[model samples]
Target chain A: MRLSPRTWTLIILAVLIALAPVTFPSAFYFRIGALIFVNGLAVIGLVILFGYAGQISLGHAGFAGIGAYSAALMPMHLGLHPALALFAGAVLSGGLAFLIGRPILRLKGHYLAVATLGFGILVFIVLNNEAQLTGGPDGMAVEDLGLRAVSDALGLGLRTAEVWYWFMGLVLLLGAFLALNLHTSPTGRSLRSLHNSEVAARTLGVDVVRYKLTAFVISAVYASLAGSLQALLNGFVTPDVAGFLHSIEWVTMAVLGGAATVLGAVFGATILTALPQALTVFQEYEHLLLGLIIMLVMIFLPAGLLPSLGKTLRQGESI
Target chain B: MRLKSTLAVSALAMMAANPAAAEIRLGAVLSVTGPASFLGDPELKTLEMLVEEVNAQGGINGEEVVLIHYDDGGDANRARTFATRLVEDDEVAAVIGGSTTGVTMAVAPVFEANEIPFISLAGAVVIINPLNPWVFKTPHTDRMACESIFTDLTARGLSSIGMISGQGGFGTSMREQCIDVAGEYGIEIVADETYGPRDSDMTPQLTSIAATDGVEAVVNAGFGQGPAIVTRNFAQLGIDLPLYQSHGVASDAFIELAGDAAEGVRLPGTALLVADLLAEDDPQHAVVTAYRAAYEDRFEEPVSTFGGYAHDAFWIMAQAIESAGSTDGAAVRDAIEATTGWVGVTGEFNMSPDDHMGLDLSAFRMLEIVDGGWSIID
Candidate 1:
């Protein structure tokens, strides 16, 4: 029996995901793995925005901040469950994206980038300044998601981080599958068209404005989900989650791993997530190396690592 | 297929052979990278040096101190993640870290929830207030520094002062405390101004303060780029009025970064920096000299207040663990809480549950720059 490409991808992902845990030296590695998945989830959203739709956001961390703060504040203040707060964060992020995207998306290139930057800075300033409500710069506590309790009740033993790692990995897989499906859908086609040439897409009745807004809102939801997962996993939140540097780091991860491909984004996230641990010896040189990698990758592999490698492989096969 | 299967089997065999090892792991979630990188970088080095020192001295009660260090990149969320990992996975004996108040605050609750002992290098008073029994601080808080500064200003007969601070957690906290403490000294704040963290030129703020009527002295609070810039601005404007810097400028980096402008700048800080100026008979002199020599020999850099605090934090923890006779978090917390007359590189630490800040105003001395080095002012 032959497997279709989608089925083959799923099977491969499942095998890798299941087998990865076996190599852990300690449960510490599980927490790191969970961290990678949470960050990967955010990068996947960037792939939808930058890779598929050709939209740039320098402030996606703002949505992530909203998601994290929601997960933290709503559960404590409103007495809502953490899972419900995660949904509330996503909805809030979506609504924010909708309201801000309408005017901001109309601008092109650097103007749009600056406007989005402003929006992110605005959110960050609010979170940082509203000390009494948000616990100020000192940050606040987040409620646990109770996944460990559920596993305990079911007689399935798992560490706190192990559960979060597996859960987040499953969520990432689902997010990737949905994003891949969207890449081949009619709406995805319109987004790609608009990405290539907005004027031409408009002429072809692609409804460029609506498609762009849709992509922004969808990506915001993804970022919000990633943020909520991070808050849940760490059981804490702070305004720095929505800071400018974090926003840049997420974009860098997506662009570095070949934003055009789901697998590439995941690969990028994983590499970055693990690089700091591996480069512990080069303590001072870490930042220099990171800056150099970003520069070299942009210069040499403009389409990113995975996409460029795929192109080379295809050409070699043809030869 | 056979090769792949063989490889998989070998990988599984390797994993199974390596069992999880139990050690008294301690986590240091620090700002190893970012604008606050200087603080975290030295901290990491100091921590490494301390670990080596402890292990060389036969470890903590026969159990090796395994440090699980994480770079917060000066982000609070990353700090929290590292703290959680330390508590939930590494099962750290105590989590020590957070170069800045923001990161420390972010990670404190995780320590509180898990009942893991935490000690912060950040000097924010709120860090230990409404105190979680699990949390304690080594560096003197801003409130103490503010009180000391106000006392010094009163002695100097400077009753009217101008204020300038950077707009950040440390800066805002220090500024607020200074304002509150100034009233007790009958000191009036004639002018007040603030600059953002990224602001390079504080000339506008300084110039504005200089213009204020009857301002006898200027109190500048903030660290890193902000203090350096403020110092240069004060000098350039030819403001002969005495300029008082917060203890945040108690590093050689400030003198080097601020150039000639740092000369004559009065500041308040722990006794460590000016140990050489202390009488040879003073009890703290010997410890200070030894710490300075050891640190300089190790890192090839002059000892700053950061290194002093980091050294104190590690030594104090070691002492607590020794007193507890175990690595239990509760035992260590109890030992630390009951600390008294614990002489360290910084000052003699005396902690109680009511005051997690071990050192009070008496632990600090007024310092002024003379000939490009810190000198005892009073």
Candidate 2:
């Protein structure tokens, strides 16, 4: 029997995660791998907001900043475990997205974009200006998540980066699985319908406001958790995590990889993450080269990498 | 498709094959291409220049030196990854260079975990305050700049001062450091104010400080053109009080931006600025002059204090390795900690168990702007 598309995507992702290390020439790649997974998880959320719901958020990194600070401050101030702090940050980000989405999501197109951008900048300013609490622009250190200790106790003998790589890979797979499942669910259909036309979906008896809010809250939680994982992995957190550029980066990754697909977002995350590591060999010209390459890709693949490639393959097959 | 194929191979290309043995590899993670590139670019150039000089002189301890470095683009996360790669992939004997305090702190845990001797070029005190065993720094801390200005203030018999600081990392840190250490020099801060990094005008903040009671002098704790704008605004407002700046603005860029207003502006800076003015018999004159001349000749640019930080970090690492007589991590770390009487472009570094950054107020020369040039006042 042929496996379902969702099953195939999960299997492929798991295989890729398990197999990528074999190609790694050194342990340094483990850190790079972990970074890709964290970023991938974030872009997956972008797929839901931008792809499924046909809405845009330019300030999702604000939620990420909130999540990262939760990991750093919660443990030190509230005496919570670093792991629990991660959860607290996710809940906080979700709740904030819900409250903010109600009024802001009413705006369409450029208005919505500006509202989200303002929200992001607001968070960045707060994180930066509240130097007394957030360590200001200098940022602060985060406590370890104690997963290394658990792995050591379990006799896994994996290194810190390696442990994080596998854990984050599992998280990304879960994120992808849920996202793929949501694509075919009844609520997912409504969300996708709104993407085509909100007015049409509303006339068809869909609760447009509730669907939009749900997508926003879910994506915010995903962004928050990704931020928490990144902070915990690096053992450091900074305001840059929640900066506007980082939010733009998430959108760039999602759009680059075909925003409508879960696996495509992951693929986008992988290339963008790995591209910088690879381009570092260019030395001083790295930024110039990175920009040129991204522009070239967008010019060629207007519909994005995965969806465009899939269409080309289908056309070829029909011919 | 060909481009995508090249992209695939590029990730693999990062995994360079390990070089031949019998060479001492020194890894560096610097902000060579980002917001802090001013600091990191000169630093990377200086380190490359130093390594070339060392190798041309026929290698240290008969082993050829290799510098494996990465441009972190001033991102802390990238700095951490590069630091880890230096430890796990390159497996260098020692590591140096984190161009900002944020980068240094982010990269510190990796070096500490791997037991690699790290010499940072950042100016934050938090880097070496608690004294991580494997970590040392080259440049004087922000606190030293604060103390240097306060020392100059006390010498001028100024008991009260007004301060304006920027909101950037270097500015706020120096401001807090100044506020923390003001009592030690018997200097009372009569007024304190702050401005954002992008604020084009500081008239509001400066006006308040000038109007404050018994304000004998004004101090600006910031880097970049922010301090230059402050100097211009001070002139515009005609606040005829002594103006002091942090070492963060110890460059020709500040003087040019402030124009005529910078004439009497005073700040603490590295000896490199006044290398030509040093006494012939001065210990640092020879080292400082030689580096400035060579760097200027080679790079076709005037030497910066940021480059001086890298110069000091490199020399300190070399001296530690030479003293230890091996490339072993623990030995090099201990040797770096035990360093003493080592003179470099920055200052005479004297490392110890308790003090990883071993510079005092004397390391900073109180420089005054005179006719668009730096003049040593103390």
Candidate 3:
């Protein structure tokens, strides 16, 4: 039985997610695996914005911050269940993107980048300085999601790391499936049309601005959901969720892994997230070595890891 | 399929490469680089030197002690990852490290979840206030510092005072702690002012503090050059009221920054600052002077209370393992909780189950800056 490419992507992602844990040295690797999925979730959103629609957003972490703080704050303040707060964060992020994307998406090139950068910084400053609410730079603790407790009550006997590992893996699979399906859907086609050339896409009767905004809002929801999961998984969240560096990191992960594909998001997020954990043995030289490794990758794989590797494999077949 | 098989083979091979069973593995996740390096650098140095000494002395219980440490780069997120790595991958008996309150709180849940004993070096009341059974710390919390400062104020008969604090983690938390406990000390906070971590001039804030009625004295809760800048501003304003600072600025660099204006300023400082001034018979004098000499000799850097926190934490963990007679996590935790009258660089520690920090206000000595040097005040 043959599988469609979309079905093939989902099948591969699911298998990899299940199979990777078998190689884990211990339960600790589960936490690292979960960290990759969380970051990959945010990077997947970037793939939709930058990859599909050719729109850029340096403030997606702002939406993430809103989502994380929603999980952290709404549970404590408004007495909302944590799972419910995640949906609230998603809706809020989409609404915010809809409002801001209208004005900011009109810019092109570096101007858009700088404008988005300004938006990210504004969110970070507010989160950091609002001491009364956010706990200032000291950061605040998050409520537990209680999934481990539920698993224990059901006699599943799962640890925190393992629970998050399987939960986030399932979330990543669903996310990847949706993104892959969107790649061929009408809206997805419209987004891709705008990505190739906005002027040309408009001449083809596609609402380029509307498509771009749709991608922006969709990506924001992705980032926000990822952020909420990160908070719940780690059982803590700081203003760093909305910091400028975090916003930049998501884009870097998306682009480095071949932003054009769903699999690329997983690869990029895993490499960037797990590299430091592996390199921590370097002690004082960790940062230096990390920079060198990243630089080498970009120089050699200019089109990104997945795409470049796929191109090489295709050429080999032709030969 | 090929990559999966290869990865499984490698992972199996790695797991088979475990260390000797007789060796006691102690894991650490420290901020040995980045913004908090001043604190973590000396901590790493202290741990390295002490581990070498311990292993050289025929080890603990005739078995070698192995130290497995990771540098967090002062990032709280990395701290959590390293915490899990310490407990699960390395599978150490207990952990000792956390350079900042932010980092400590970040990893506290990891240790609590795994039921591994953790001795934190960070100085935040929250680290110990809630008192997780598996978590303990060495440094005097900010609450203790605030209480120590207020004690001096009440003794000096200064009931009314103005306050200025920085907006960073240390200052902000310490300021809140001071306000929370001020009523207990009979100290009335008449005026409040603040400065950012990078503010060059605090004259405006200082001016407001001085102009406030019944402002008999001023207390500054901050570290780094923030207090130095405030001292300069206070001198410029010539308010004439007594000025007090937190232990955050107890180092000599503050004296250098404030220069002549540092005279007559009092703050809570560790006994390490006045080690030479302490009586030879004093219990803390020997411990502090030895640590100070050893650290300064080995690292070629001036000793700091930050390093002292690590020094105490290492000994506390070592003592717990020695007393427990085994490296079992629960056994070592109970041993640590049972600690009492243990003398180290920080002070005499009297750890109880309820008080994980184990140090009291006496851990902080009131030191006055006179003639551009620290003077132990009675």
Candidate 4:
């Protein structure tokens, strides 16, 4: 039986997750693997906004900052569980995205980008300036998720990061599945239609404004969740998570890996995430290489690595 | 498409199965791939050289040091993640890193909780405060650097100073210290202006400083972009009063990046840059000469005070490890805390439970750039 594109994507993701551990030379790989998943989760949200919905957010890291700080601060101040803090962060990010998206997303093109950038800067400024609560520029400590302790009690012989890696991988898979479903659903079609032409979608009675807002909120939630996971996994939080540079880095990862494809974003996250580790010897050339990669990829593979590669494969089959 | 998918899957599987196993693993979380890359890049160079030197010297007592470094890209949370991975997964002997105070402070608790020795390169007192046993620092804290700068200014009879600093932690800390210490030294700060990190031009701030009454010198408590702005604006605005920069701006890059305006910029820094000026018979001459030779040969660039700090941090850790005769965190911590009279490229580093900052004012020398090189002011 031939699998649909969605099914194939799911199967590929599952196989990749299942096979990742086979190559783990040490438990350190699990930590790195988990990092990739966490970052990939954020990029997956970008796939929904930038790829599926054709919207841009220069400050998605702002949501990530909210998620991270919420996870760090909520438990300490409100006496909530860390997990509940993660949920609260998501809700907060979603609500903020909803409220801000109405006015900011109303602007189009460069204006929208700049507006979002300002929003992100505002978030960063707040997090940094309100150091009394967020630990200022010095950042703050996060409570442990106690996953290792839970595993210890359950007699599971896994390390703390190994557990986090597997758990994050599961989260990524779930995130990817949800994103894929959104891509195939009617709302997804509406979002895509709006991406193609907002005016046309509006004329077609698609409620372009509402759909765009939905996409923004959904992506914000995804980014928030990713940030919460990062805080939980790392056991610390800082305002830099929401900094403008971080937002740019996330966007770079999305576009570099093929924003349109969930797997591609994950691939981009993994490659970019591992590049620094692999290129430790060429530390000086890191920026030159990163700039070159971004320029080269955007110039050569405009559709991104996966989409361009996918096209080539289709062409080969047709031939 | 199927073949590509299969290859990717197999590759990931291969990565997952091969986990690192090494003794005496050292993790570094640095700004290796960001705008702050200038500092992190050289620091990484110094670290790699130190690792090579240590390995060549029979590998940290025959156990072989394995470095697991991550590019935090100057992000604090990412640094924290790397620190966590270093502690929880790599089970590293120690961590040495953080180009920015934000990152260093973010990663400090991880080291504290894991009881891992963490030596921060960033000059933030918050990273080592309240007596975290596992935390040690090589860089002179902002407080020390501020006091040193004020001391130099007072000695030079520059009683009235204008201040400009970025809004970041390093800048704010330096500014606060300058305010506190300037009063102690009977120096009056005439005007204080602050700019955000991304501010490309400080002309407005400099213009304000220039207008301040009786300002004899301008003290810039910032690094990287901020210093570049201050120096350029000082020249452009033609505010010819003497300019004193924080040691954070004491780099060859700062001079080059700041153009002709960097001339006569006074700052408190280690003897690393002006090492060539020291007589060959001087105690610090050999250490500086060797570091300069190795660093320039390897990275094709002049060494900064950062490299000095990096070199000293690793050497201090090595000395502590050797003294402890093992990689035990508590043992290394105790050894480090007990460190006294240990002379290094930066200074004679002395540490105690009450004072984690290894050096005081004596560690720094006031330097003035003349003819495109550093000259120590007697």
Query: DockQ numbers for every candidate?
Result: 0.30, 0.45, 0.42, 0.35
- The best-first sequence of candidates by TM-score reads 2, 3, 1, 4
- lDDT of every predicted structure (CA atoms): 0.82, 0.89, 0.85, 0.83
Superposed model 2: Cα runs more than 4 Å off: A317-319, B1-16
Give the TM-score of chain B in candidate 3: 0.95
B1-378, model 2: which lDDT tens digit per residue? 323432463355356657568999999999888688999999999999999999999878888899999998888888898898888888888998899887888899999988889999988888988889998998888888888898899899998999999997778888899999999999899999999989999999999998898999999998888999999999999999999988888888888889999999999988898898898988799999999999999999999989999998998888788888898989888888888887888888888889998877678899999989988885
**In terms of lDDT, which candidate is stronger, 3 or 4?**
3
Error of 3 at B293 (Å): 1.7
Local error of candidate 4 at B191, Å?
Answer: 4.6
TM of each candidate vs. truth: 0.83, 0.96, 0.95, 0.80
Question: Which pairs clash inside model 2?
Answer: none
lDDT of 1 at B230: 93
Worst 10 residues of 2 chain A by lDDT: A278-287
Clashes of 1: 1
Cα error, residue A61 of model 4, in Å, equals 2.5
TM-score, predicted candidate 4 vs. hidden true structure:
0.80
Superposed Cα deviation of residue A127, candidate 4 (Å): 4.8
lDDT, residue A163, candidate 4: 91
Best by DockQ: 2
Real A-B contacts recovered, model 2: 0.41
Q: Sorted by lDDT, highest first, which candidate order results? A: 2, 3, 4, 1
lDDT of 4 at B216: 91
- Candidate 4 per-residue C-alpha lDDT over B185-207 given as tens digits, one digit per residue, 9 for 90 to 100: 88898899998889888898889
Put the candidates in DockQ order, highest first: 2, 3, 4, 1
